[model samples]
Target: ARRHALRDGVAIVPAAMPSQANVVSLRMPLALYGIAGIDEIHDSVIEAQAISKGDGIKGRAHHVVDSQGASRIGRYGWKADIATLKDMVANAFANELGIT
Candidate 1:
């Protein structure tokens, strides 16, 4: 029901439970859009925010944070939680699904 990084980290085979597939399965594609691939996630969030600032939506302007506590426009996740792909990936592995 979960995915683990293989020794090579090249291909994503599968998990014990395909139905309960790991968060990676759900996250990888989405994360790709967030990290490696494009700025679609950020663009969409920006465009939507520009059109309508939703205090209602689960994610709004989730600015990024640094060690100094400084932050910038968050371009990832529902709440725009993190600012960078590295952080996003880390967060994903840590707490995205709440399974761990």
Candidate 2:
């Protein structure tokens, strides 16, 4: 595949089947790792502001920011960093293949 890709400029490789749950972006400081189902997508939004406060081994069941930056709800991808689906696709493409 490598040789073919190098010579032919492209090669198709099958990917492993995916599971229902997948990783998406989180707003950072309170990262949401994996989402199981579409139904559970907005479940975090309502509580995106609550967290465990105080010092030492601090962990938030969820996270919140003081003045705000990104919002609690994101649709396109995890952390909802990219503003559009197109941006997400481009970023994923670049990161995966190291080709921007």
Best candidate (score: TM-score): 1
The residue-level lDDT of candidate 2 at 41 comes to: 49
Q: Against the correct fold, how does model 2 do in TM-score?
A: 0.26
Which pairs clash in model 2?
Answer: 24-78, 25-78, 25-79, 26-79
Give the Cα lDDT of each candidate: 0.58, 0.46
lDDT of 1 by residue, 1-100 (tens): 6565667576855656667655445434542632554343545556465654456554445556733476566666777766666667777777865644
**Cα error, candidate 1, residue 60 (Å):** 6.7
TM-score of 1: 0.38
* Candidate 2 local Cα displacement, residue 91, angstroms: 0.4
List ranges where model 2 is wrong by over 4 Å.
1-74
Backbone clash pairs for candidate 1 read: 1-17, 1-20, 2-22, 59-79
**Residue 8: error of model 2 in Å?**
47
Q: What is the lDDT of residue 76 in candidate 2?
A: 44
For candidate 2, lDDT tens digit of each residue in 3-54?
5545776767778757875857654332334523432445364345334445
Tell me the lDDT of candidate 2: 0.46
lDDT of 2 at 33: 44
